[model samples]
Target: MRLKVFEFDISNSVLINTQTQTQHHLTRTEAQVLEQLANHPNQVMSKGQLSCAGSQQAVMSESAVAKAIFTLRKYFGEPYIDLIETLPKKGYRLNISTPPPEWQQQLAQRKKLIILASCMMLIAAITLITAMHQYIWFKTAESPVRESRVVTLNNHQQIELIWLQSPKKSSQQVSNMEQKIITAFNLCPIVKWRDVYLAFSNDMQVLNISMQGYSSNGELLVRNIKTSDFSLQPNFISPNWLQEVSLCD
Candidate 1:
């Protein structure tokens, strides 16, 4: 009995037509390997040369390259080695025809999609970080401002009272006021007198006072004044109706 044989074109691209008559496509790397094999036909190309040809910096291991070759053979169904032969310790040569036009187009499309998706993800991450930073800045800008005051007595016995005005007015205005006060008195290191008394005037409503004194060693002594229980009389002097109580000895 004579066997029936079917003739099919193998040149174009690597394709696996199963016994069930189903066609499967190859990836670009696989196709490139097959193309290399087609070019070498009978000679074995080294793994290094093949990797370089594929624009890869590092050459794949021999076993890995062999596996790729095996996959290519399986994809073509029949032994593609008739056109391309794999030489041990050597590279593969082209023994098969070119891949089908449709396969090449599909591979190109897949690569393009991969590149586009990666770019989009990077852009999205950058935009999210920028928005978060802006939100943080706005929150800090909207928070209530903190107030501080300083008073200094010069060697000439002149009194200088310094206080932080509301920053909402103008930064330049506040800065200028502070500079003017500092220049007028030429006050030495402002010291918080411990024996000073604090009191609120009958006309005032709300007052918050914070005092920090530095020791000879540059250590800070901090005091938070809440209500008007302390006095600001002969020991400590300030122009403001509210005053900070001196807690130091």
Candidate 2:
């Protein structure tokens, strides 16, 4: 079901800022967290409830669940900090008022449908589609804000820099080049960091990066930077946006 978490729209596996209207991807478990909180709006969802969102990461570890919430807060920034409330040992809840009568009926239907869908594939498909509408019944709701839309990448971003010197190069040189980019960012362990998007632009003379870093002191800084910052040039095809490359090896 979809509902407004502050100015952001909470849809399953996705969060859209109503004003900007840009979609944000949610991990399977994070989606589960929002789903449960939404299911019992204004009511506490015990840690156990949030942890058992029932995705591949079923029964998420406490730390994992915490991380998901951290990510959520970081993305949304400060204005709606109280969108999710914590009740000590009780659990976390969305600080929304009770939904309307029709919403009550829809919730009932969702429960029934969940019980009826026997196939795993069909269930996944439905969950994906279920995000379309949420019938939250509340009056004097916050009006939508207007802001420039920021696009979200479809693929998981793992690194910060891209090379654009030449499309034909050596494998070792390419690997080394990627390492240099990854190492350039002085990422701190205490801060929340995400690799937004890295790509070559301007006739392969510069690299463009859109990234966000949330400091431990609760400062969020975003930069859309283009730089000819690299000192190394490697041969080989350039990396595709959001596809290819596994740095774990």
- On lDDT, the candidate that comes out on top is 2
For model 1 the local lDDT of residue 223 reads 58
The global C-alpha lDDT for each of the candidates, from Candidate 1 onward, is: 0.48, 0.58
What local lDDT score does residue 210 receive in model 2, on the 0 to 100 scale? 60
| Residue 90 Cα positional deviation in candidate 2, in Å, after optimal superposition | 2.1
Residue by residue across 78-174, what tens digits does model 2's lDDT show?
A: 8766778778888788887765799888999998887777566687867766764354333675433211222222233233333333443445644
Score residue 9 of candidate 2 by CA lDDT.
40
User: Whose TM-score is greatest here?
Assistant: 2
lDDT of 1 by residue, 1-249 (tens): 000111222354435343556554655555556555545545567867665545657445555666777776665556434444666665666543444599788999999999999999998988887878776555434423233344444543333233433433345544554454345334334444322222223322223345445566777666555443254322122434212333232
The reply for model 1, stretches above 4 Å from the true place, is 1-103, 119-205, 215-219, 226-249
**Backbone Cα, N, C clashes tallied per candidate:** 25, 6
- Give the lowest summed-lDDT range of ten residues in model 2: 145-154
What is the TM-score of candidate 1? 0.28
RMSD of each: 17.2, 39.3
